[model samples]
Every structure is written in C-alpha cells, then in structure tokens.
Target: MASYKRHLNKDYTVMPNHHLRNKDLSLKAKGLLSMMLGLPDDWDYSINGLVAISREGRTAVENALKELREAGYVVIRKLYPNQTDSGIIEYEYNIYEFPQDEKVACQDIVYQEAHNQGTCFQTIENHQQLNTYKSNTYNKRNIKEIQFDLTGKEETDKCPDKSTPEIELEIDIYTYNVQIHDEFEELWKLYPNKKGKTNAFKSYERECKKKKNPAKFEEVKKGLIAYCEYIKATNTEIRFVKNGSTWFNQRCWEDDYTIQNGKNNQTNKKAQPEYELL
Candidate 1:
C-alpha cells in the first residue's frame, strides 16, 4: 500500500548468471526492477540511490538503469536539479506498476481453479476463531455432511474436441516459507538438457536419477506437496490418502501438474524447451 525504498546493501547486487534464471532481462534490468519494487508510490528516489541498492558499483547500476528504462518498466521523467552543480544531470524515475487488470484476472482464475479442485476459503481476520473451529471439524470427522460437494456438472472437455477425465485428488499439502532447496537447483545444473527442467517441480525427477536415490525423490515430492499446502493457507491442513505410489510435484501455481511414472527421461518428445533464458 505504501511506497518503500531499497536498502543500500551489497547483498542486493544483481549477478550476471542470475539473469539467465529470470529471462527477458539482463542483470542490470532485473536490478532496476528490484529497485523500483523496493520503492513506495509517494517517494521519488534518486538514480544514485537505486544504483547503490542494486549494484556493487556505480557503473553496473547505471547500466542496469538504462536497460530497465528501455524495457518500459521505468521512465526518466526529468532531470533532478542539483542546486550546487549547474552542469550535473540527475534523472528522476517514474516507476510503473504491473497492469492491475491482468493481475486481477490471473488471480481470479487461480482462486476459482483451487476451489474447483479442492476447497479454498478466504481468511477473515475477525472470523479466525470460527474458521479454525470449522477446519478442525472438517479435519477430524471426514464428515460427509459439510464436505465439499465436488459434484456439480464436471467439465469433460477443456478445448475443442479434447476430452479428459474430470480429475481430483485427496492430497494434504504444506507449504514452507523457505527458498527452494539448493539440491533442486544442483539437479538442473547436472541435467541441463532434460525437458521441463526449467520448472522447479519437474526437476525433482532428474535429481532423483542423478543421485540414484528413489527414496530421496519421494521425500522431496512429499515435502513439495506440504510446501504447496503451506503457501495456500496459514495453519493449513490438507488430508488425503495416496492409494499407491504417487508423486506430487513442487511447482509454482503456473506449472502443469502431470506425473511421470517409471521413467527417468523426458517422455514428451516435443515438450517445451528446458531452462529459462534471459
């Protein structure tokens, strides 16, 4: 709601290889974006300040600012007047916010999809006590009376003439507030050619193969499912039984949720290319 500024610290410096991790921008561009996000709506921060926050040196920060300006995420409105120096040029940036319409539309779809798949309830601060009671009730009794009735007209077709079974899974998920495990990233470094490796969740399979540890793969998958549950709700409880050997992936909401069985290689010959490009 309020504008904020990036702290001037070395930890925030943008690195070259990180650009590959977040395609569509060079390290400098990414640094500028981070700087803008760190600012509040009311404050007009100087270019020097932004550079200090995002880059290790002045030149790197300046270069990143130029790239961000070209990308249209930032604009140089006018020169900031430095009363003491007449020849000095200081550019004041007008940062842009993400398009609200697109973000709202995406969030709407996510909210609806989560509801249709399982149960998603919005949190009400005032009704926290009541909601916790209901959640506990729902968790303890498998009571059919108030359980979500997922039996409205099931959508058999997603696209024109493409019919797939209406799918549902009873899954208990927990999300963690930690960064993705470094082992997952290491797995990608090992099998850079694996399709869908760009997806953080799908990388688990390749990791298991590289380590030759099937048990570790299962552990990671379960941990991922728990992490997902954790992100969806606070003090969340997801209760579901996996009847057989099943796998849950650790993906962001946008990633597809398909399971690979008894396979260690990319199955889809024409799957999207692996790895993100900057």
Candidate 2:
C-alpha cells in the first residue's frame, strides 16, 4: 500500500448553458463533454487520446465528439504538418476546441416552452406533443375536481403515528444500504474491468461493516479514482485489471501507483494474486 497525494487544481472549466439545455444530446455525449472539460488546458485533443482518457471505445468517443460538434459546442480542425525533406507527407491529428459563442438556439426554444408549461421538457420529439396535451388535460381535470375533506380526523387516523426508535433504526439501516449501493455503483463505473459486480458489492458491504465508520469509505473511493487514472495512463489492458471484488478484498487502494503526464511507470510490480472469497 502506498500513500496517495492528490494534486488539487484551483482552476475550473465553465460549462456552456447550451450544453445543459440541449435535451437531444445523448448521455454519453454529456459525459464526454464533462470529461473533456476536466482535462488540462494544454491537453492534446486527439480522438485516440480522448478514448484513452475516457475509457470509452474509439467509436463511442468519435460519435460523441461528432454530436458535440454538430450541436455547436465544439469545433474540430484537421491540421497538416510541414512535408519532410524525403518527400514524405504526414497528416497531423485533428484538434478539438470549444466555441465560445456557439449557442444552440433550439435548446433555448425548448427551454422556453418547458418554462411556459411549468414542467420539464421531454427529449423525444414526438412525445413532446403528447406530453403537452396530457399536461393540459391534467390541469383541467384537477381544476374541475377540487374536493375539500371536512373530516380532518379521518386523515389523521389513516396516517401512521410518528416513527418510534425501532422504526427509525430500520429506516436508518435502509438508507445506509441505499447509500452503499450508490457508492458502489460509482466505484464500479471507474473500474475498468467490470466483473463479479454482485460479489464485489457483497464484499464492499462486509468491508463497510468491519470499518464501522462510513467516512472511511471515502478513502477507498478516492483511491479507486486515482488507480483508474493510473491504469489508463499506463495503457493497462482490461484483462490485466483485477476484478472489483478481488481488488476490494485485497485493499489495493493502499498500493502505490504512480501516474505522470498521462503515463504510468509502475509496471515492474508483480501481478496481483487471485483471491477466492469464501
């Protein structure tokens, strides 16, 4: 286990309003936008480089980039370097940049309609018309059927009493389980090798019980994020990555992994041994 020091950057990228307003953009495109925005200012914006950083397949990255470009959120240009003396011509990689004033007016129009309707806008083009009609019908029906209940006691009797300690304890346990489930989901997304997720979550719960304190879970989460980046920078194949349950059980977050300039130099370490859970 190694001590991980996180480098904090004071700078932040500003997301354009159009990106959020545009409901037509796919989830993958939205994710890709956020990921790209987090990159260093001087990052090389090649498609292959983006694929490596995002851990998304090349085709997915390409399609997302194309979507962003068409949506006016990004601008990509092909560059050609100088010809070599040996009469060899090489094509430079495509450069990606954000357009400052590239606002998607369609998104604004959709947002205005949503605002007027007093509801969130639907992304589907055909469904929007159906939703508007349904909303209007719902409003009219509610206005026509406004009924008043004079017997307040009936309402009180139907509701359960305030939660006792036992009930509160049960609720707390349920909430804790939900939180653990959500945290595990986030960790699983960062893990390159998605194997034995069910087993991994079970192991995570056991580990959480052993630790007792929920705050300690942050250490594992931070370590997993750092490890993900380290493995990606090192160009480690998905096959070489350990299963989530195995990694969690072994507490690999403590292992020292080094990442530098989107490259890692810690391949000399021995392979992680496979662990069979009882």
User: What does the lDDT come to for candidate 2?
Assistant: 0.51
C-alpha RMSD for every candidate:
25.5, 25.5
lDDT (10s digit) by residue, model 1, range 167-221? 1111121111012345555434432133343444434433432323332634554
How accurate locally is residue 75 in candidate 2, as Cα lDDT from 0 to 100?
37
Write down the TM-score of every candidate. 0.23, 0.37
Query: lDDT score, residue 255, model 2?
Result: 69
Give a tens-digit lDDT track for model 2, residues 214-240.
334788888788788787777788877
After superposing candidate 1, which stretches have Cα over 4 Å from the reference? Answer: 1-22, 41-44, 79-92, 98-278
Q: Name the top lDDT candidate.
A: 2
Clashing pairs in 2: 1-254, 2-254
Scored against the true structure, residue 153 in model 1 reaches a CA lDDT of: 32
Model 2: ten consecutive residues of lowest lDDT: 127-136
